[model samples]
Target: MAMEASMVKAVIFDKDGTLFDFTATWGPWTADLLRDLADDAAHADRLARAVGFDLSTCRFDPASPVIAGTPGDSARALEAALPGMTLDAIVRILIERSRDVVPAPAVPLAPLLSELTDRGLALAVVTNDAEGPALEQLDGHAHHFAFIAGCDSGHGAKPDPDPLLAAARALGHAAEDCIMVGDSLHDIRAAHAAGMRALGVLTGPATELPGAEAVLPDIGHLPRWLDATT
Candidate 1:
């Protein structure tokens, strides 16, 4: 059930699987990028040698519940795979390539976001992605958010309290006064670590998610949950 608005000052969200269909949004881009990489003899060999997976045989396999991790740690994972490459360079490539991967706005997540703003609730995004793609996705939904921050934006990522805590601070609210909404257990854990409540949505594969205050079907039902809470 949704908690009262009086009990919640703001809402923190995770991007990707939570807001939009992850596969529909990022899968194509990943597939195309892998294809392009595989087509390059050097990069193809690197993919086989580094990741031990052939780029050509790859498909954009959708992963379960999206969560967050430490910014530097997460970045390092991507960077470590591409030795000697600057983080900035890698992030730029990912962001540029991701442009071809469009979000499924048909999910009506944008309207829900606008509704949250209209309800006078503060909003922010704390994603696990690098700052570049994070901002690009947010700006793509510019009509929705009042403030958006990413794990790479400096505070931290999910599964740690830093990101949620920073977002609460930015919204001028206490952690207890904010609610974290996402599609993963990592998000739920993060909210708990941050001293906030969590609402998980089943928009993504549910098996990978952790516990939450409530688990609903998707963001579209969030309004109803909010109504129940209020």
Candidate 2:
């Protein structure tokens, strides 16, 4: 059953695949990073496997830590692959690369967010990406978000509920008064754990998340879904 939009006072979005097209936004960057870190084909393959990416396809496994893991998690994976590199150094590299990425929004964001705000719903972004890059990705749209938390924001990361709960608290809404929209199981699971409604989107590799109240083609359809449900 669709959740009643009337009951939702806030909307929390997962960045990366939720707000932006995961492949379009991150595929090239991942490929480039792997190449820069590896000295040879054999080494590149090792790094790819360590991060759960397939070099041949340049696609990440749905279970890949890179898909939903925090920068520290990714650094750990990279550290395993490159024994000489320290975790902090790996983290710095990832953060630097991330800031340079140009996000490809799943839909035009400003107008859509405006519509939601006009409806009196508070908005936020809770992402596993580092806070710096997440903010850079939002750019002009950053002002629309009432709260923005990243892995480094000290709220912890999803599929833990700390960040989601923090976002709700920041917005002055109870967990049940918020909806979390994302394109991964981590996002859905976090919402469930946080006592918020979960709405999944297919802009990423995830297609059939088990606990999503609705699986959408993309966030572009969210307004209509909200209207119909409310």
Candidate 3:
């Protein structure tokens, strides 16, 4: 059974798609990366297919492994496209280049995060992104989170409860007292697996996902949902 939103004391957020507008932040970067690495238009298509990116639209496919998969997973998917490079080489390049991409926040982060913090909710970030790049992307706003963990940060990635459980403990809250807010099913799975409530946002490609407890248009609508659900 779901508890009232007012009872929640901490929030665990997914970085991409949830906090940052997924396509707006990643689409152009992926397109540029695909072009930079590919041999030609045909090669670009192949590369795009490998990562589940659509070059013509510059948007990621909903089923794209890159959307929720780790950077290492993305590198392995790309192995067949690049002949001479090893997976480790590709992963290094991806991580190095990733550090250069600035995130486009879904809403003005300062106010939204301030609102949450002001409500006495401890905040944390859990992302499938590598810890280094994930921290870099948060930039000035990293201060908002009490904890931030990525796939490389010791605990296992999402769809596994380890990181979520750790984040809740780090925030000094039980899983049941926290909410996992994100834009992917991976977030939902991890949240549920960790015994937390899951809230979804539509900042990514999907209009609606099946497993979310509630689906909002974006994180901006969270206060309203909290109000109504309370």
Residues 106-128 of candidate 3: C-alpha lDDT, one tens digit per residue: 99999999999998889999999
Query: What clash count does candidate 1 reach?
Result: 2
Work out the TM-score per prediction. Answer: 0.76, 0.95, 0.96
Best model per TM-score:
3
Q: Model 1 off-target regions past 4 Å?
A: 1-6, 39-92
Give the better candidate number (1 or 2) by lDDT: 2
- Which lDDT tens digits does candidate 1 get at residues 1-230? 23333477788878876786654565456546545645367765554444223345432222312223333442344565566568776556655675555666426766787888888888888777666766666666755655577666778677888978988888899888998888776788888888888898766545445558777777788778888885
Clashing pairs in 3: none
Estimate the Cα RMSD of every predicted model relative to the unseen true structure. 4.4, 1.8, 1.5
lDDT of 1 at 86: 84
Each model's lDDT comes to 0.66, 0.90, 0.91
In model 2, the runs with Cα more than 4 Å from the true position are 1-6
Question: Could you say which candidate leads in lDDT?
Answer: 3
